[model samples]
Target: MEKGIKAFQCVEWVSKRKVPHTIDIVDPDPSWPTTFTQLATGIRAALPATVIHAVHHVGSTCVPGLAAKPVIDIDLIVADPADEASYVSALEAAGYHFLFREPPWYEHRLFALYAPPVFVNLHVYGPGELDLESARHRLLCDWLRKCPADRDLYARVKRESSERAKANGEGVGEYTEYKGATIREILARAAADAAAAGQGREETVEAGRAETAEAGTGIE
Candidate 1:
């Protein structure tokens, strides 16, 4: 939970309609943690031994007292995400559908489970790629968790953004864009805090890499 990858007790692939295009921010639910734990367990069971390096419950949902859009955001850190063929097939068999491959975004690979009982955005990233996204994600989450003022501000901005999107007939994409300003502001503060504490992005990426090394390329 400290923005570092930790090996979790073991923890998908398929296809279906993508997530809904609407944005509806709701009060934080008590069940988010349970959902994440259950999902992590399922993922561990689905994958072959040693395929996953670390499983982290990231995003706003992971922060207590933060309102979110009711969807889980998970960061699936691997040794080398670019080597998708090594693990993608096993994930597909677990009922997770490949959504997109965005090399420009840290060679990120997104997978999702859109059926009942679980709605998650599985973000896969490797250590060698541009690790900006993973660093920012964990930093911001940890920051909001520690700072109550920012947490309230984020909740307010999210609610207003969601309402504005609904009133203006805007979709989730637009809502996300509308909230980008606030998100950046918060991230700026988080980044500053991280730097002041001598924590750098390279350290974060290396943490994942270290885990992968410990995991030892054991994909089946």
Candidate 2:
């Protein structure tokens, strides 16, 4: 499904929990995609077919050979993220804990699974609600997967960011912020490449606008 363009907004977390945590960057695992597939299958089974619009494996973990934080990031496109009652309970039942919601930011909802099987960040967005952020996520993943140079560059930035965050006693948010500049640089290249190929112009424009507003906000 195609998403329309929208302005970026940094909405405060509905249920904010400010906690210091370790930012552990690990080598790429071959099993990450398999894990995402398993999780996606489970999510599909847990929710009604009519409720789910699309399921995507996004974030750094989706990029092969890219060093990441060992947490799987999944984008779950639904009919309406604001209508939580339709899908939240089922996700909770499936062992994903409801973390928070950002109604102003594309009606985004976040769910997490921090337990045994595997850790996952399940991001929910409504159709036409994920304009820029969604486009950026997909572009980044595809670019990194095919472009080894950018993939390596991102890996180095991630490691540096993790080290700096750890040294300063910062959490995931700060760590993510540290990598913003490099992320934008990489995305710009990806967008340029797409434009040259005469494809994904809409996605490139939307994603570029998103980076201009807030680079690396939703990345990883």
Candidate 3:
């Protein structure tokens, strides 16, 4: 599918059934990474290697010390997410329930696994489809890993959002929306830091090249 806002107009819900649940944000679990590793392993084993591009542990659960909902969010990059025939049956056989898909928004497809002791939100997308959104996820995760201040700030917002959602009988969607502003603020900081780091690297490389050229001229 062609990617862009025009594609979003074709958003389709595979199932309209809503699952009832409370928004419970918990303290960081040390086991989250291990859980992701095991899950990723199973997912890899289930599908053909040719179709799988990358599997990433994303979202709040992946960040250490960051409070988050117990659910783990994973990003599974496939050759073509819109081509469900290539891997959907395999994922289902592996216990993932196929969820809705947003064809316009990066050819995004969602799958869920509600097994006890571990809940997972498996997000599927094509390689180049999630360029911007994927970058945002990467930057936010990298920044949270190193920036204690923003991590704590995000945790506080998550708790507050969860509390408000529970009090108002809202679902996960509302809870996520409640904390959107804070997430955007943190992402902005992360993007600035990333840009600065990239510029520094470019300048350093240019300086090294200039020094090498000067040294070569003197040797002759």
Model 1 clash tally? Answer: 12
Q: How close is candidate 2 to the true structure, as a TM-score?
A: 0.87
Off by over 4 Å in 1: 1-16, 202-220
Summing lDDT over every window of 10 consecutive residues in candidate 2, give the lowest-scoring window: 1-10
Encode model 1's per-residue lDDT on 4-73: one tens digit a residue. 3322221122343466633778789989989989888988787755567778888888999899877788
Query: What is the full ranking by TM-score, best candidate first?
Result: 2, 3, 1
User: Which 10-residue span in candidate 1 carries the lowest summed lDDT?
Assistant: 211-220
Highest lDDT scorer = 2
Cα RMSDs, all models: 9.1, 3.7, 11.8
List, residue by residue over 171-201, the lDDT tens digit for candidate 2. Answer: 8878878887888888888887777777665
lDDT of 1 at 44: 79
lDDT of candidate model 2 versus the reference: 0.75
Q: Give residue 217's lDDT in candidate 2 (0 to 100).
A: 37
- The lDDT-based order of candidates, best leading, equals 2, 3, 1
Question: Candidate 1 lDDT (Cα, whole model)?
Answer: 0.68
